[model samples]
Target: MRPTSEAELSAVISDATGPLNLRGGGTRLMGPFAGNVLETSGLAGISLYEPGALTMVAYAGTPLAQIEAALKSENQRLAFEPPDLRDVLGTSGVSTIGGVAASNASGPRRISVGACRDFMLGVRFVDGAGAVVKNGGRVMKNVTGYDLVKLMSGAHGTLGVLSEVSLKVLPDVEMQLCLRIEGLDATQSVEAMSAALGSPFEVTGAARGVDGSVVLRIEGFEVSVRYRATQLQSVLARFGAIDLIDDQERCANIWRDIRDARAFASGDGDLWRISVKPSDAPHVLETIGRNKATLDWGGGLIWCEVAKGLDIRAKMRVAGHATLMRASNETFAKLGRFHPEAAPLAKISANLRARFDPRGLLNPGLMGAAI
Candidate 1:
């Protein structure tokens, strides 16, 4: 079912008797759900944009490309650097802004700035009972109390169906410089990233590829970028030889590849995304014992490919969470899509789901068992 307007969306939900699998752009499909498809693509458009204020408001189903174009025209961007997962996931449809929020998608820059939820200012969603709930506002300071704006993000439509979102944007930088340190092992690479990230150079991206090359990005005015690059090179010189990539297009492509995890886009192995303290990254790598992995967010986020049906979680001795990002339906059903929360946390999540989706009809079993 596709609803063209908010009222139509609410009516459809209000009349629903079973699970409703929420869909936006059809790009990041994580479901083998038992429910009628509820498409939000029809509810697409930018409702507001203030370049001076560095803010944007768009309907949940609005294509991400459209919003990026608009932001680019004004020399601004969604600083969180949300990744385009269509290629990695092998999906064809356009990516929607709602999906970005639902997944809390962020790229390497996330280590410097924040995640998708950090930029969100407000949200308008239809709860399970078809009740329209609006929280927060266009400006950052307008958000107070419960902070449902953040609550809606990364919820994956379990609590409610997002209809619109307000976000904070950042001005685009004039120059970008990437410093590459080659031939470093995982531990050394993480140390190098830690040094760069800890520096005052304002490194925006830190990632290590399967090729054993560490890339750190610095952005701002041309002179500032050049100055910081020099400083960063000196700091990282102890690690290895540093190659400065000043070409605009080349740097963009480098980051784009890291952002999308292009390394693991192919092959038949199941993909897993593990999040842990940056310092514990080396141990996690040792535990997983997979050379085919991409470290982003300065090693806080690890994307590893493992053979299907192999439970990486069981092998993990680190204190972190692992999500089964890509797998067959059977593997997903057996292992579950997300890591099981601890008993106390699981109870809190269950109570939240119960409060928002009283009927337990919204994306049931997509994140785990139904509410």
Candidate 2:
């Protein structure tokens, strides 16, 4: 169902057939799923902007490019640095800000700037009850009841269908630089990556790719970026470093994959995204070292493409949590890669789902077990 207006959106949600699968652009939803899809491409436009307050609100269906362009006009940007999913999903375009916030798709900057949820000021959505509810507000500070606005940031439409949203914006950096340390093994790479993050100097992006390399990004004024880059180079000298001058196109290309899990999209093997403590990376990778893997998020995230017949669940048990990035339909259905039920907080998740979508009609089992 296409909803061009709020009234149309409300009408779509009120459908009694099944729980609605709220989608913006329907990019990620192309994967496996079973539900009545509610396409929200109609709800588009920037409703309000307060430059003095550094806040903006846009319809859920608005393209991210439009929002970024509007924010750029004021020399501001979405600080969380949401990545374009096209790299991993092999889709044609970037993810919408609505989908980015809904999926909580933060990038390497998340270590410093914070996730999409943190920048969310408020939201306007239609819950399963078909009632329009508003949470938070356009202002920076709101200490009202439960922070439903923030809660919905990563709900992936399981709770409600977002009609519009309010977000905080940050001024763009004057300059940016990415420092690379090539030819380092995973162990050395992790060490250098950790040292950079531990230092007083702010290092924005950190990742070790499949090519046995480590890289970090520093952004700020020219003087600060130069100084921090030099300091980071000095610290990582033991790992044999190489300086990557920040070129707009090159920078965009390198980070596009890092942000969207593109580096691991080489073959048709099953793909897994593993999140773990940075220190435990070596052990986990050694355990699953046989599989093709690349490190991101400073070794905290492991992209492992496993051979067929391997037990992906066992791999997730070893690591903390794993998401099925790319896999066959048989693998997806049989392996059950997105296991929300196995998570420790599953019970509380069920309760929360009931509160937001009591009817269990929104994207049931999409993210696993309705929770």
Candidate 3:
């Protein structure tokens, strides 16, 4: 099913008696999808573009490349710096703007600013009941009730079919510099990242390369970037030889992979995106049998590629959740996709799910039975 307009979408949804497999860009069509296929690609076009105000509202199916190119021309970008999961998900489909919002996919800059949810100004979607719903507003200071925009940010389309989204954009920084400190182990790298993040100089990106090298990014005005880099160099000199990957192309290449966890995208091994405390990184890695991994979000996010059937949630004792980013249908079914929610949280989640999707007919199995 394809919906070219919101009214057509409502009619199709209202008439449907079975679950619909909502597809956006097809870049993140992981896990099992039941019933029939419903494509959002037809709901395309940017309805609003306030470049001076740095705000944009586009149809859910608008290609992210289109939105990004438009933002680039205006010297602005989505403040959250959403990931292009096409490469990581091993799919060729263009990443859609709605896919980014549905998954709440954010990049390295998330550590400095925030995730996609933080920039979500508003949203328009068709709920499971086939009713059109709107939340938040086009401007930044929206004080409406319930905050459905946030509720749907990472709901994975279990709640509704997103028709449109409004977002806050940021001006592209004038300069960026990355301080690559060599030879630090995972734990040491986390410690270094912690220090950099805690310091006065604004570090936009922090990650430990697979080879155990630490890279920290700071962006701002050209003079401020240079000054901050010098200050950071002096502060982090104890870590070891500190080199600079300040060139735009070089820096972009390295951070792009880290942003999307592309390093582990090649293998057949199950990929886990664990959200643990920065300080608990080493323990979490040890619990996962010290698998090959890349640390992002200043160590709060760990992307590890490990053999299939490994029970990461059981060993993962930290106060965080592990999401199975990529795995086969058998592995997903056997091991489950998302971490099980706590009892109290589970009840609340059930209530919310009931409120949004009473029939359980919207991407029913994508989040697994526990959700």
Candidate 4:
């Protein structure tokens, strides 16, 4: 089912009988696509775009491509760099802006800027009760009470179905440059990434491929990029020959691949995304043992391809969070898809769900048996 407007969406929810699968372009689905389905892609178009204000408000079903194109025209872009899930998910579907917010998707630039939630200024959605709810506001710098805007950002559409969203955007830098340092071991890679990130160069991206090649990115005015790249080179002279990647398209492709975890997309095993302290990454991975893993976000984010039934969770105890990025249906069925929550946090989650969706309706069983 597709509703082109909020009123249509509310009416659909008001009449919903059982579990309804909320879909936005169907790009980020995990587990089975059971139950009746509702698609938000029908609700499209940008409601507002104020380039001077660096703000854009679009209907939830608006294609991300549209937003990107519009932002590009104004020399601005989604700084968080939301990932396109089609390639990684091995599915053929265009990602919608709403899906990005629903999944709280962010990419390579997220390390420097922030996640989708950081730019999410406001949202309009339909609650489980079929009521039209608007939180936050159209313009930025809003402080009008309960921040349901954030609560809904990564809720996976469990709390509500997003009908519209307003986001904060940043102007695109004039130039993008990268330094590829090769031959760095895991420990060395972690240290190098940490040093680059801590430096005043304003490094925007840091990624280490499984082959021990680490890439560091810096973007800004051409002069600033050049000067900082030189300074950064001097600081990392000990790391040895650094190949500069200034070619616009190539640099973008590499960063885009890193942002989307495309490096592990073609691998055979199930994929797991582990988030840990940047400096603690090497130690954590050493304990996890060897499995094809790519490090991103200056070692804060690790993408590992582990085989089925490996119980990858038992490999480490970093006091960090782990997400099942991509896995077989059987694996999801046997083991919980997300990190196991402790009692205290689990209680809070339950309360939030009950407060917003007491009937246990929206996306039932997607996030741990609903309520």
Q: Rate the local accuracy (lDDT) of all candidates.
A: 0.90, 0.78, 0.86, 0.87
lDDT per residue, candidate 4, 68-117, as tens digits? Answer: 99999999999999988677768777789999998899888888898999
Report per-prediction Cα RMSD to one decimal: 0.9, 2.2, 1.3, 1.3
Candidate 1, residues 1-371: lDDT per residue as tens digits? 99999999999999999989889999875848888999999989999999999999999999999999999999999999889888777788989998898888888888888999999999999999999999999998896789898888888999999999999999999989999999998899999999999999999999999887999999999999999999999999899899999999999999999999899888678889999998899898898785488898888999999888889899888889999888898998898889988988888888899899999988887765797
Off by over 4 Å in 4: none
Model 3 off-target regions past 4 Å? 368-371
State candidate 1's TM-score.
0.98
Tell me model 4's lDDT, rounded to 2 decimals. Answer: 0.87
Give the residue spans of candidate 1 off by over 4 A. none
| Residue 228 local lDDT, model 2 | 84
Residue 94 lDDT in model 4?
75
Considering every candidate listed, which one attains the maximal TM-score?
1
TM-scores for every candidate against the unseen true structure: 0.98, 0.92, 0.97, 0.97
Candidate 3, residue 45: CA error in Å? 0.7
Query: On a 0 to 1 TM-score scale, where does candidate 4 land against the true structure?
Result: 0.97
Q: List candidate 2 stretches off by more than 4 Å.
A: 29-31, 244-248, 316-319, 341-344
- Candidate 3 weakest ten by summed lDDT: 362-371
Which of 3 and 4 is ahead in lDDT? 4
- Sorted on TM-score, best first, the list reads 1, 3, 4, 2
Q: How far is 180's C-alpha from truth in model 1 (Å)? A: 0.8
How well does candidate 3 match the true structure in TM-score terms?
Answer: 0.97
